[model samples]
Structures are given as C-alpha cells and as structure tokens.
Target: MIKVLIVDDDFPVRMFLNKIIDWNKHGYELVGEAIDGREALEKIEKFKPHIVITDISMPSMNGIELIKNIREKKYGCKTIVLSCYDDFAYVKEALKHGANEYCLKNQLNDKILLKTLKETKNLIEKERVENGQYESMKDLANKCLKTLRQQFFREIINGSWKEKKDIREKIKELKLGDDLKNKIIMILEIDGFHKLKFGPHMRNRQILYNSIMNISKEILNDFNDGYVYRVTDKQFLILYSVHGEKSQLNMYKGMKEFAVRVQKNIQIYLNINMSIGISEPIYSLDRIDEYFNQCKMSLKSKFYMGDHKIILYKDIVKEISTDPIKISNREEKELIFYLRNCQYEKINYYIDLYVTGFKERNVKIEYVHNFFRRIILIINKVADEYDINPKDIYGEDTNPFRVIENMETIFDLIIWIKRNIEIVTGKLRPNDQNKFEHEVICEVIRYINCNYMKDITLVKVAEHVHMNMSYLSHLFKQQTKNNFVDYLKDVRIEKAKELMETHNKKISEIAELVGIRDRRYFSKLFKEKVGKSPAQYKKTIG
Candidate 1:
C-alpha cells in the first residue's frame, strides 16, 4: 500500500484529510496525522510514507520548514501542500523547498485529493522499480546505507552538522528522512547498566542493545513517527511527535503510559531497570541538542526524584515558597522517637507525609535536597548519641552522612535511611530472634499489601526486604503458611473483591488496578480462589 501521512495544525483539517478519500482502495495507507511541520518531519522518517499532505501554515515547524527538512533528509516523497487562496506566496515558497503540489484549502475536494494521491503513487512506484535495478550490488548498497545512517544520527543529534549545506549533503548521501520537530525528546538511561556485572550468558552487547530497541519499538508501535536512536552507551533518545493525547494533561498521561510500558517490558525481558527524562515538546531541528540538554537536566531530577519515573521538563516547575521548609520541634521529636524505637514503618509514614507536603507545594530543588539532608543528619545524630557506627549497617564505604551530603532526592535518602534502620535494628535488638523474624515477615506482607497494584513480583519484594530471594520465600512461607506468590495473589484478590463489592469501578478496570492486565485470567483466578467469578461475587455482595 502507498503510505500516506497527513500534517495540519487544525485538528479538523487533519480529520478532513483522513476522510477525504478511501485511501486503501486507492492503494494508500493512512500512516499518521501530525499537527505541524515539525511533527510531520518525525512522521516522515518513521513512516517513510510515499506522500505527505501538509498544511502550508502551522505552528512550531511550519510547512516551509517541513519541506526543507524533508529535502535535507533526502526523503524522496511527494509533498502536497494545503494552502489558502491568500497563502499563494507561502505555497510558492513551499514548492521551492520541494513541495510537489499545492491544494487550495477553500477549493479542496475528493477529486483534487485523489488525483494528487494517484499521481504520487505512480511516481513512488516508478522510483521503486528504478531502485530495484540495483539488486546486483544490494549488499554493498545496504552496508553503505547503514554506515551513512549511523554517521548522520551521530552528527545531527550531537549538533556537529549545524550548517544547512553540510546537513543537506549528508541527508542526500545517506538517503535518510527526518520528520522531527518540536517533538518530545526522551532520554532513557538503563539504571546501573554500566555497573552491571553480567555473566557469560549476557555478554553480547549488540544482542542486549537490539533487545532494548525491539522492546521500545513494540511498545511505541502506535507512534508512527517515533525515532529511537542510541545517544550514548547507556542512553537512547526517543524523538516522538507528541500527538493523540489531546490535552496537556493527557499528553503527560500518555508519556506516563509510554514510560510504564518501556520500564515494565525492560524489567521483565532484560531483568534491567531504566529511567526516562522527558522534555517538554520542542520545535526546530537545529534545537535538538538543546532539547537533549533539557532532557539531561530532567534526568538530574532522579537524584532527588528517584528512579523508574518519567520526569517531564514542564513538571520541573520552580514555584518555590519564600518561606523555607522547617520541621517543628514536635515533628523532630516524633521522628526521633520512631528512629530510636526502630519503628521503621512509622518513620516511613512521616517521611512520605513530609515529602508529599513539600511536593504538593512544588518547592525548589534546593529546598528538597535540604529537607532530606537535614533528615539524614538527624539520623546520624541518633547514631552518634547511641554510640552506633552507621558504617556497620551501610557498609564501610557508604557512610550515610557522606552520601546524604551529595544525595539529590528525598526518595534516595529514604531508601538509604530505611536500609540502615533495618541493619541497625537487627543488630541493636537481635536478642529476640523470633520477634525480629516475625517483623521481617510482617514488613514483607506490608510491602505486598501496599504495592500489590503495581507490577510487583517475588524478586521485587525480595529486593525491597533486602533478603535473598530464597530466604525471603522461606520466611514468607514459614510466617504465613503460604507461598509468597499465593500471599500476593490473595492480597490482590481481596482488594479486587472489595472494589467489586463497592461497585465503584468496572470489573476490567478493577482487574487492572489490582495488577492483572488480562481480565479473563483475573476472572478465572478469582473464581478458583474465592469459589465465585468476579461478576458472581459482585452480584452476591450487591
């Protein structure tokens, strides 16, 4: 099928273009709909459509820039410009930039659109047949194309080819196309990738890299113009034309879904974790490097924001309250009480409450760092007063005092403090071995109860408890008289039952919120465990 991309700033215009023709019947596939030229550029590269129908005037990357960018990428596709009668000047400019034809918007009709599409199809088919003549040197041509593509991505994204002539020459030589403008640039870094001491079975870096790319492509298949390119050994840049989300809120929600899918797939398939820093949608091909830098700045949020999150540049708003975050004496004394008594859960609650309060206000980063640093210092003070060496708990090299000084986020600080608390608690009060083991099992159950809605697994829980997988499993089974998996499922099933009884959500949504993505599997499991299907249980409760 002849691939076709529709680019227009007006939502209605884009829709009109889509409905103007029965594209499939005319040997065309509607690959994507982009709001502006910049987004159109990204779509062009991704879909590599035979024809691009674009509006002459649009925000961010306008039609003129789009045509120029398409030419620079050496994308040999017909560009049909949608223009107003008064936009004849822009229409002429678009043609000069390599737009193939102009369609007056006021005079737009199916006949005009179909004729252009048919002609573009014929041109693309002829070119394809002509290019087929190079079969004798296919391998040589493929090798050259691959090398060119690598060099171009490296040069363009890195800001080395800023000159128009140089960029144009490279695009022609490489036969590459770019439909990227003011698109959201996502910088994804595999957490602890370089630090990973992989065994022999995972030695092939290319295989691992390809696996990552495959996962990204599959998850982002809906993004027709999304381009995932390797930026660094540990990082990838995803230039995705942000569309379909509808509103700013939905855009963020979309990015979140994108991040979740990538993170979930990576953890499941590669046994690896990754963090993504997403920039606010940007325009201008020349500004890619700048946007990448913004993404880097966003990643810095991880230092304080924690990992496995999609940090949006826009959300990094700095509306700092003039008044500093000061903990009252009462609050300090309460925290001290929890720390002294080794009430780990209570400590976590206070920390979360404080963090949530500050975050809701959208305090400055410095204030967040100061807050966590002070909290850690307080912990250190406790250790000193009790004649306890924190080094004993958090290894000799990782002095919590020293780490907190450099730590960025409250989340990281909480992790450090909780881990040390566990170590110190076990040591300071190990006389009650039975009680300590019971506490460990209880913590495991608490964690499951809290995080069962997330993609939690035995391995994740084991890590959270800081115990060997086997050891955690044994303890869980001993304490609960049920396997860890069974306990987790029971918690989820119970929660699902509660939600069903309340009749607050659809059964499918309840299944998803309770961690099961497959509604059928959830139904079957619920019936097997509770002696009734979810629907039956809900009806009985009602």
Candidate 2:
C-alpha cells in the first residue's frame, strides 16, 4: 500500500479531503493526519509515507520548510500543496520546493484530487521503474553495478580484497563510508520454493522474488537503510546499517518484524514463506563476508528451528553452548568402516547412539552441529583413502553442511549419508569386490553359523580358512554385510535366544553358551537389538 499523509490547519478541510476520496480504491492508504507542517514532519518520520498532502501555510513550520526538511533527510516522498492563497508566488514557491501538484482550497474538487493522485502514482511508478529496469546500455550498466556491488562484497567477504588502499578507493567509488560502524548482515531465502504454487520455472520464480523483494524494501526502507543483494537464486543478502543508540535486541525486533512482514506479504500475495537469519551487529566494511558466513551458519539453525520466521545469531549462540567438543578416534574409525562397507543402516545406528549419548550427558547444541561436520570430514577422508574424489560423490560446489542443514530428522541424515556413501563406493569399486574375498567371506559366514557358541574371532576365521586376516576382514564385510565382530554378535545373540527359549537355562548360563564371557554385557547388546533382556525374552516363552 502507498502510504499517504494529510496535513492542514483547518479541521474541516482535513475531514473534507479524507471523506471525499475512496483512498483504497485508488491504491492509497491514509496513514495519518497532521494539523501543521511541524506535526507533519513527526508523522513523516514515523510513518515514512509515500505521498504527503499539506497546507502551504500553518503555525510554526510551513509546507515549504517541511519540504526542505524532507529533502535534507532524504525522504523519497511526493508532496502536494493545498492552500487558501492562489498568489502566484505561493504557487511557484511550492512547485520549486518539490511539490508535484498545487490544489487551491477553493478550486479543489473530487475530479481534480483524483487526477492529481493518479498522476503522482504514475510519477512514482515511473521513477521506480527507471531506477530499477534495464531500458538501454546506461540502464543496463546501472543494473550491473548492483550486481558488481554484490560481487565485490563477495570478494571482500571471501578475503580476496588485496590491499587496504584499494579497498578505500573502491569504497569511495561506491560511496561507502570508511568509518568502522556497526553493521548487521541478514540472509533470507524462500523456505520451500519447490512446494510453492508458482516455483521452479525461472520466469515465475523471478517475478515472485522481485515482488517479495520490493515489498521487503518498502517495509525496511526507513529502518534498515541498507542494500539488498541476490546472493543466490533462493537466498538474498541484506547489509543493514546500524543507527545511533539502537540496542541489539531492538535491532532483532525490527528485523523480526521485517521477516514477519515479508512472510505476511509473500503469503498474502504470492502464497510463499521465507526464513531469515540475522547476524550480530559488527563493525568494519571488510568483515562483511565473515558476518555473512555467520548468518549463513545461523540459517542452518532452521533445520532444528523449523521455518517461516526470523532467527538471530546471538540467540543461536545462547541456544547452543560454547563448550568445546572432540570426537573420539574410535567413533571416526567406526563411521569410516560403515562408509567403506556400505553398511548404511549401521552408520545410522552408530550416529543415533552417539547422539543419544550426548542427550544423556546434556551436551550443547553446537556439539550436534560439530558432530555432523566431523562425520562429513571423516567421510571425505575415507573417500580420499580409496582414491575417490568427493565431487564425484557429492557433486560440484556441494556444501555438505547445507545439504544436512535442512534435514529434519535422524532418518533424513541417515538417508543423506547412505546416498553419499553409495555414490563413493559406486565410483571406487562399482562391481562386486574381489572374488577371493567373496569366497573367504562365504566360508566365514558358514563357519559362524555352525560354531557361533565357540570362542570366535576374525583371526580364528581367517586362519581356519588359511587366509590373510586383513583381506579376510575386508571380505567378511563385503559378502555378509557385517564387520566380523558385529556379525559374530548377531550370530551369538540368535543362538542365545534359542538357548533361552528351549533350554530354560539361567541368563548367565545362556551367556556362557553364546561365547560371551560377561553376562551383563551380553544383556546390554541383547536389549540394543531385541528391545528386551535375556531373562525378559525367556519369560515370554511358554
């Protein structure tokens, strides 16, 4: 809506102007009214109206002085003068002070008022289009400058800006200030574009994005006073200027409103939702990229946070503790083993158990974030060991963190890990593994099925088959889909179950028969797999 404010000293005149016009029907909203130019300035600052209709002369400040003040403050508002005086000087002076139209109080009618409002609307739209649209080489260059601005910002953020001298020159050329002032970065992206009604197609997406951006700029114009850039097809970057004495919380409130406004507008007009990630206020022009990355990282908080609102980096820090964490060497080895053998389900189980452990210990959320990153790093390392490049698995320019960021569940993470491992294993050894290894694995599986109650080990099996332990270990996972110890446990657990049902043996006696030395440890593994203890399993049997 184009906000319109009216200012006139005569109460009847203000009422007459308002009652005579169907503002909404003509695409204008009457935001407020002021009795004089002095009051109008206050309203103008508060409402940030698009069109101001005011009397030429009034108490304290007059229309001419109001216009000058508006110009000094850089308000892009179209003003219209309404006056009792039809003097030539008053008309020329109002026109000279940036009034688009002058409607004399005596001559004013519905027809003239409507015509003036329409003309003002046409002028505003034309000016906006001229500022934005590409009609020629000059227009195109102007548009490219916006794109170039984003490119330079990306270069600076990505640490490519070479020298401080060059930085200052470019900032001067772009009219960017040299002083280090507090600035906040926000990254907003349409939450679920594919699910939106008019998405996927380039043309439709562009129209939707442009409409949302324009609406967002209109809402934030008075508050943020910053440049907005299209950093990615789905994401937009906003460089927010921090003004005097605004607390960080107030900034967040304003940005939260900005997000809520965008969401309301997009949903109302385009039927879409957006997620905004806001960075903490920081100083210096060069650290834009760092702030941007912080916002990007916070954007991933949406996976844990859900969608359709604003999330602050400061709050994200508060939500996730800053406690340092380190993954055990054993955990990395196990994850790599799963990735190597294509045992995706086990990989998932390992991750689930580890996370459950964290919850039990009350570990911080940042650990959860770091945990996934470490897992991905482990996957990359294993791929490297196999002489496999990750791009072949994950695709070029693939941000594994981003891929995981949107994951809503452990099951989703499992699916992602599974797919990545399958891709790498496909490229590394697409066909079935070595034939001798397959033969060795089959022999081991048969041996385990026959003598699961015996004290069994990978070495025992490898020696029984007269094979190298390492090669046999590799083959055992390839053919039977289990590492030696896991497969042995599986066999022993099944055998123990049979002993429990038919033999009526004590739990410890059954544990002994399964080649498990510790009955307590056997029950722990049993509960993990069967969801019941050996005694509990035996009690259910008739």
Candidate 3:
C-alpha cells in the first residue's frame, strides 16, 4: 500500500482531507495526520510515508521548509501542497522546492485527489525501481503496518474513534478480528518503570522497552488467544478472547494463570517485577474504553496490594469500601504532640493503628492516598517548627508527595515513614539532648563568626537556627559562658584587631570593616576588652 501523511494547521481542513478519500480502497493508507509541518516531519520519520499532503503555511515550520528538509535529508518522499488562490506565491515556492502537485483548497474533490495521488505513486515507484530498493521499502512498509496496528488499538482504548462503524472498519482493515465483543482487557504494568527508565541500571530505555515487548509477545503467543499493545512506556494492554471459556469465572482463572506466567518470565529473564490488572469480560464493542479504564482502576489497587500480583476488577469491587479515613481534632493534637516531643514509640503505635484501620475497614484507595499525604505534611510541619529541613531526614532528592504517589504498597510507605521518623526523633531524643544542644551551640557560633561583619542580632541568629530566641540566648550563655551579644561583640573586636595589625588603615575604616559603624563606640569597647584605645593600640602594635 502507498503510505500518505496529512499536515494542515486547520482542524476542519485536516478532517476534510482525512474523510474525502477512501484511502485503503484506492491503494493508499492514511498513515498519520499532523497539525503542522514540525509534527509532520516527526510522523514522516516514524511512518516513513511515500507522499505528504500538506498546507502551504503552518506554524513552527511551513510546507516549503518541510519539503526542503525532506529533500535535504534524502527522505525521498513526494509532497502535495494544499493552497488557496491567494497562496500562489507559496505554491510556486513549494513547487520549486520539489512539491509534486498543488491543490486548490476550495476546489478539492476526491477525483482530483485520486489523480494527484496516482501521479505521486508513480513517481515513488519509479524512484524505488531505479534505486533497486523494493525489498528495503517493502520491509519499511511492513513496519509501518505494525505501527498502524498499535495506533489503531490505542485510539480505540482512548475513545478517539467514538463511532462504532469507524472502529469496526479500522479493525477489519487492520485484520485484528471479526468479533471482539466477548473480550477481556488486562493492563500489565512494569513496577518502578520510571526508576528503570532513568535509573542507572537500565541506561538504554528503548532497549529495555523493546525487550519487554518481545517477552510479552512471546508469552501471549503461547496462549494464542490474546493480543498485546504497548499502552505507555511502562504498560501493555492485553485483549484476550473468552471464546473457549465456558463461564466468566473460568476465564478469570485463565487470566490469572497467564498473568502469573508473565510475571515469572519477566522476573527471571529481565530481572524486573511486574503487576497486572484484569478487567471483567466485555459483551459490547463500544465499551472498550470503559473496560480499559476498569483495568487501570484495578491497577491502582497495587498501591496497597503490592507488586507482582494480579488484581481482578471483580475482586477489587468485593474488597473495597467507600469510607474515608478520618482523624478527630483530638487525634490530630495527639499526633502533633508526639511529633513535637519526638516520641517515636507513640508514633509507631499510631502508624500501626492507621495501617490496621486501613486493612480492617478496607478503605478506598483514594482515602489511603489522602491519609498518607496528610501524614507526610504533618511530619513536614513539625520538622519546620524545629528549624529542621525534611530533606535532611529523607534524602535531599526525595519528594515526599511524589514518593507517596509512586509507593508500591502500604508496607513501602510504612517503612519510609518509620525510617524518617526514627532519624528525626533520634536526633532530638532525651538521651542525646546534651550532644544535640552542644551541636546547636557550635552551629550558632559558626553562624556568628560568619556574619559578625553584618548586623548580627539574637533574633536573627535564633531564627536562623529555628530556635526560640530566649532558649537560644540561655543555651548560648550556658554552653559558651557568654551571652549572644557578648560573643558577637568579641568576634567583631577580634576581627578589628586583626585588621589594624595587618593593614595600614584609619581607625574608622578598621571599625567599619569589623561591622562597628561608630568609631567612638568601637574605641570604648576596644579599651575595655584590649586595655587600649584604637589609635593607641595601633601605635603599640607598630
């Protein structure tokens, strides 16, 4: 079949082009459509169309430029420009750039289009024969057919083809099946696929994806009653026929068995884990989108059910309840108090209680998600109160919300939360209180040393350390045997003495360098501490 691509910015124009011709009936396949020349180039690379039907003007790139790029890159495709009477200049330019034909948009008809396509087809055939590339071209066309097949199923699952007749015609044209009404949909998803895509372990994402696809195809081929389509980077959709099953229950059992085999094979061969979501049998072809959604919803149960398991839509309905997880005001206070005091034992108790409640009530998955997010936020709120960054407890790169969203199971969440809680409370536990206070004092001194040349104040320092000003003042005096102001004054005086000894400068300059704005105040303070005025001290040092 001759492959054709349509590129136009106007939605109605593209739609008209798409529907005006019975492409498959007339030795052509409408491989894909794009709204602009840039996207058209991408489709050309992927679909490798033999001819391009494009508007003369487009956003990002125009038809003339697109044709130039095709020729420059040796894509060897013929172009037909769609233009209006006012676009004569653009049409002339496009033809000069090797556009095979020009069609006036207002006068476009199927007969005219068919004639243009035939001429384009002849040009393509002549080129292929002269270049002796028939076998290679044949291979590329077959690959395009496979891509078209996947696109066909993806569109149906996404509800892109809303009309039943269009779907039926495409399915038959693709030779997928004559009857798909009695089918089951299963979504097989790779666990932690994002990690693998970006993770150091699987550096080549395409290779990993292709290997998974091959494994899926090999396994499904053994069953001989199912077909698989790549849904996303991490997911594959399986459409299985229940033709031989005597009952729905039998079909479900067969699905479970198939899923287990797939998981085992992937784990053994690729060293990767997978999860499956199985939907109930569909008796109508029109509800493929609804059934596909059922599979996706079932897959979400894996957030609590863990990975490497098959979740049945029927099973989830039996297991879940609609109740929202709740916390009373008193309960909230209790949690806050425990967090403030670093009472880890109590925190553990609460964690266990929440997990137990979730399991016993069989709470909805969304409620669980909400509960997890709320708990993390509460933890963050407490951390902020202590001037502690949550990143220090978790890793700097960790995003609590994203972690919660992607966590595979309740157990995974519990482990992460408990581990972070231990870190937070361990730093503030009473047994380590003296050490923690000493560290705080050291940090405060370092802060003073660094900022003594600025407007240093107890309030600013306290805020920097995330401590109460009074408490920080008391602790500073107790630990260093000097109050906050005395320590800050001493640091400035020492800096001033160093400057006076090292560089020849005025007393005012020296005072200002040490963050003392008034030279008289600096002299008085220096006399009291160093037993000499600024000029007298500088003379003695000289």
Instruction: Tell me, by lDDT, which candidate is best.
Output: 3
Error in Å for residue 327 of model 1:
6.2
- Please provide, for model 1 over 301-415, each residue's C-alpha lDDT reduced to its tens digit, 9 standing for 90 to 100: 6755666667877776534555588777898898888777878667767777877777677666666667766777777777788787766555567755566665545554555
lDDT of 1 at 358: 70
1 against 3, candidate with superior TM-score = 3
Compare the candidates by TM-score and give the number of the best one: 3
- What TM-score quantifies how close candidate 2 is to the native fold? 0.39
C-alpha lDDT (0 to 100) for residue 95 of candidate 3 = 93
Q: What is the C-alpha RMSD of each candidate to the true structure, in Å?
A: 19.5, 16.5, 23.6
lDDT of 3 by residue, 53-146 (tens): 9998888998899999998998988999999999999999999988999899999999999998898898888877866787788889878877
Q: Of 2 and 3, which scores higher on lDDT?
A: 3
In order, candidate lDDTs are 0.74, 0.73, 0.80
User: Which scores greater on TM-score, model 1 or model 2?
Assistant: 1
How do the predictions measure up, each by TM-score? 0.42, 0.39, 0.52
Count clashing residue pairs in model 3: 0
Give candidate 3's root-mean-square deviation (CA, Å): 23.6
Candidate 2 C-alpha error for residue 193, in Å: 6.5
